[model samples]
Target chain A: MDQTILDTLHDVIVVGSGCTGAMAAQTLLESGMKVLMLDGGMMDSKYKSLIPDTSYTDFRQKADDQYKILIGENLEGLNWGEVSTGAQLTPPRKFITDQVEIFLPLESNNFHPMESLALGGLGGAWGLGSCIYSPPELEKAGLNANKMHEAYRVVSDRIGISASNDDASPYTSGGFNYFLPELEIDSNAKSLYDKYKKKRNDLNRDGFFMGKPALALLTEDKGERKKCSYNDMDFYSDKDKSAYRPWITIEEMKTKYKNSFIYLGEKLVKEFSEENNFTTVTCIDMMDNSVKTYSCIKLVLASGVLGTARIVMRSVKSENVKFPILTNPYCYIPCIQPGMLGKSADQRRSDFAQLSLFHDPDKTNADVAMASIYSYHSLMLFRIIREAPLNFKDGRKMMRWLLPAMTIMGIHLPQQASEGKYLKMMKDENSPTGDKLFAEYSLNEEEKLSRKIREKKFLHAMRKLNCFAIKKIDPGFGSSIHYAGTLPFNDNEAEFTLNPSGRLNKFKNIFVADGSGFKYLPAKGLTFSLMANAHNVAKTVIEDARK
Target chain B: MNFAEENKYNSEAQILSNYLVGTQVDKKSLELYSGISKTTNHSMNESDLKIWNFLMKHPGFISSIDGALAFTNPKSSVRKKIFFMFAILECRPELSAKFMSSNFTGFYWVKFIWYGVHAVFTTIFGLFLLQWIKRF
Candidate 1:
């Protein structure tokens, strides 16, 4: 970074380049407030070009020097240990968690989270599911519902969402505008959806609503982006820019608001201090391993929930302070769709969530659980066959026969603040980040029993759709990556709390623009709400600055 | 790997792929597959080596050995090597379309039923042949 730029007082400083931080910077720059974004912004230098800009099926057919893309130089994902949550993440997506433990270290006996310092952070590898939080859900999260709904419209328009007004809209889509047509799904999803339609009334009465969920995928060509080609490579690469990533918005803001928007990549933000009505943000530039400081009138911490908690606790000069950590407990059940049995895999399709099933007992918002269903294939049969209870050759043939009828139902349960589940920042001299976050997360018997009961109900519902659940694969704790509830916005002037307007209660000029302010982590996807809250927080900062 | 280790891995991966895909794998493919597994620390144990030696002499015993161990322990070293070989072969386009086939034909059940019958017959035959070969 330039010394002169650091010496000059920036109008606003945004801490991350993730989904929330990008929206915050965009809102601030659109309002003509000069903004500076400091991010790690690490990108994949090796496999991005090795991957051809063709459909996943085409790549499999052509095999254009594909040794590096699937299996990395060091065999990045093929491991002998227990399977991690994102083990299916292709080699090209390694940058998402490339140096996360080094830059943002965390220690937990049970919880294993996936944090990203990549160019677009975790949003770079998002599944493109966009579940809008309802008004009641927003209220539980201590956010203004009307303002959030309006911001949802703004962000929805900015990133063209693809969805249809179907039965699942009441639970998935929160009445957002400007959506493209739904993308085409595969044979398994179509079979399950047709089965659900036949048993719609009974299923609805049993509290299961299944339909096409909202996705951040382009159905048709948009500005500088093309429509989804049904390549089934959403897990690997975004060749046609069909899926909306946070970096796309950041790139747009860089060109559109060149004078107002300034992004400094390869810089990880550390703790900040408020002095003389200006916040001095300290960062470690990864390029030269040098400590740099920049002063800003207003600072927005959108560096994820745990990232924000690390800075806040460290800034307060507390070596140890526990903050509540909430994450949607996740499990993936590979169900067998009987209707699609003995049917060939679709030639052209998407691997993203083809159908979303919401388990809302009252059909309202309270105590709801969501399941995003995906069709199998394109991730390769080896990952699935490895778990089969047959011989390798028999397992291979069995998976080849079963892949066409498989539907992976990834269910996420709503989480709340529990005493045993909290994250604390402690000093670590050995770590490069200067501090390490220790998270203690475990489910109590009551919580576990309730989740099992709900999951059993979901299994029953799946049976109604003619999908048989063989067994459940617990990917592990905090793997959903929808971490939240740390430093939630409250009225009191607590050290680890924020005001309703996103201003830090203990500090005057600092604010949070991420899930750190969320009081309740709803079962729905939180990316759309995170972006909306960041936009609303930026607008609130502008409003407060005028005062 | 040295010359011995490299040759051993190539020959083993070849036999595994031959059994899984019903075809032989090239040297380059074998080299790449074994190169990736070097970091995995999945080399065979004593019993796994015992089974490996038996399969080396009687390649048809792979089905029986793996099928018997499938229910008891699927993560055996020999089983893992077979999976590793299958994974490398799946990367190729030679038989991927066939591997991805659902057998969506009028006689789909016939092939599926025949596969089940072959599985039972091979397992019974291998159980006797392996132990009988070990005695000799």
Candidate 2:
């Protein structure tokens, strides 16, 4: 196992091929460093080959292994031992908040959950509702807004967004558009907007309704992509229109920087060491069980929260390496009516289907994203209906009861707070496996208040819009599916906090630009923030690496 | 009405309709048993047609029929309520054979004995097979 037998050392190695990894790879390569990326996802999306067929039948085909993870049909049969590329790989059981006890302080259980481990990361499954973190929220998160905003512009320029400039309605005003033209608003959407506009205008919250939320979709027919053809299908999967998947950006980077290499289908970095100012990463080739080492002048830990946490806690151990992770508290709001027969008649059912509500943070300085609430289509609706933990075998019973249901996702503030807390590994003689994931969490007081406020806002908005029979429920941790915080920054002077040139401090010639670096946000999806921060960090790495 | 003119009219209105309800169906789409033509009209035996007409037109007479033949016994791979009549038909022909046999003539008297025993069993067991007997 001599190091000389391994592949040639690259300038950097990136883990996790989701948003953060893809953005970091593109930026680093653009800055003239040979970059190597490793992801736990498959080599390509299931439907990547058939550009013309817009059906999701490919995902259901035997070739796709459709039940590979959460999106697959064989979820119940897969072993939990196979689930974790992250820190805590718990077995699937009933959704219980207080069952397993850990050393961390116990608290309320509230969280926002969203996760996917596909080639494009969550972008593959995201509703493509692209929005940047509001200025105030970024400032609260101790990030440079101007720099982050520039990064978002670069991302939008590369990925092509579509949005309308109209600001006359409550649900549509003041939002930025993508690179593409606005989607033709369907007839149902026009009617609903007209019906609700007068009421929305009277409420006077500066809120407006628009055709489709700004999306990172393609505008032209290029490379397995087609122009938006008014298909009205976004959530489950679209065959004709190409929603932005990060693999496309990564591919573009490969053509621009031929020297850079990105390897998919590899997992688990086996070892890392520094000698002669060069940090070497030896990762396990998960497919063949072979180990290979990669070297670079600088390394970027751009794997996301759960990913960064798993890698760090597995590699680094000590009482003092503790960092606070952030959890998003999320909820679903359903607006039902007595006469509603579960038919797809409303404009919201087909158009952009976006909804917006205001959020005030639960805690001071808590990083929160602008939590937008919108309806879920069939795929998501099926999952929500199946969430009752009812026996799946009772098909007839489910058919009778599961209809007439709709859901809207509400992101709570104190975006970083959660009832589930994290714990560091402790030394023990009787330990069978290595250091275990220790977490004890519950919703904090402020997060609960944020949920309450969102409930009130949804109720009020429903009444104003004449959307009747609205009811609210509390969604617990792990449901939001946005997990982070194993490696986080507390203040500006953390030794491990900033690498070098204002990156993670302790690791010279190393940078951490992923979601694991953030303490938390009150409300917002972290895509824009992740890209912007990666750009700023890559700039510092490129500037200082030469020196 | 010659053959060519008659064929041309059939081609224009080739939809298959339900024999009783007249629900129109695409002839090509319906999954039928082997040898069943997609374009052919729905058919039942003359005996079955008589039974079906009687049942539909006079619903009250159905409860009064003591031992009537079943109509339109469509055989399906899917196990359903139609199997009860099929099972009775498969089993009923055995009864007359037992009555005609020399040794089974004594079993005719055994039927009386068995009836007395079933009556006692029903009195004790609360007539558990009453629905089956009523169907028979």
Q: What value does DockQ give for candidate 2? A: 0.01
**Which is the leading candidate under DockQ?**
1
Top model number, TM-score: 1
Per-residue alpha-carbon lDDT of candidate 1 for residues A290-318, written as tens digits (9 for 90 to 100): 89999999999999998898888878886
lDDT of 2 by residue, A133-169 (tens): 6566566565666776777778777666666555321
TM-score per model (chain B): 0.84, 0.21
TM-score of 2: 0.63
On a 0 to 100 scale, what is the lDDT of residue A162 in model 1? Answer: 92
Instruction: Please give the distance, in angstroms, between residue A309's alpha carbon in candidate 1 and its true position after superposition.
Output: 1.3
Q: Return the lDDT, model 1, position A169.
A: 84
Each model's lDDT comes to: 0.83, 0.46
Which docking band does candidate 2 fall into? incorrect
lDDT of 2 at A87: 13
| DockQ, model 1, C-alpha based | 0.55
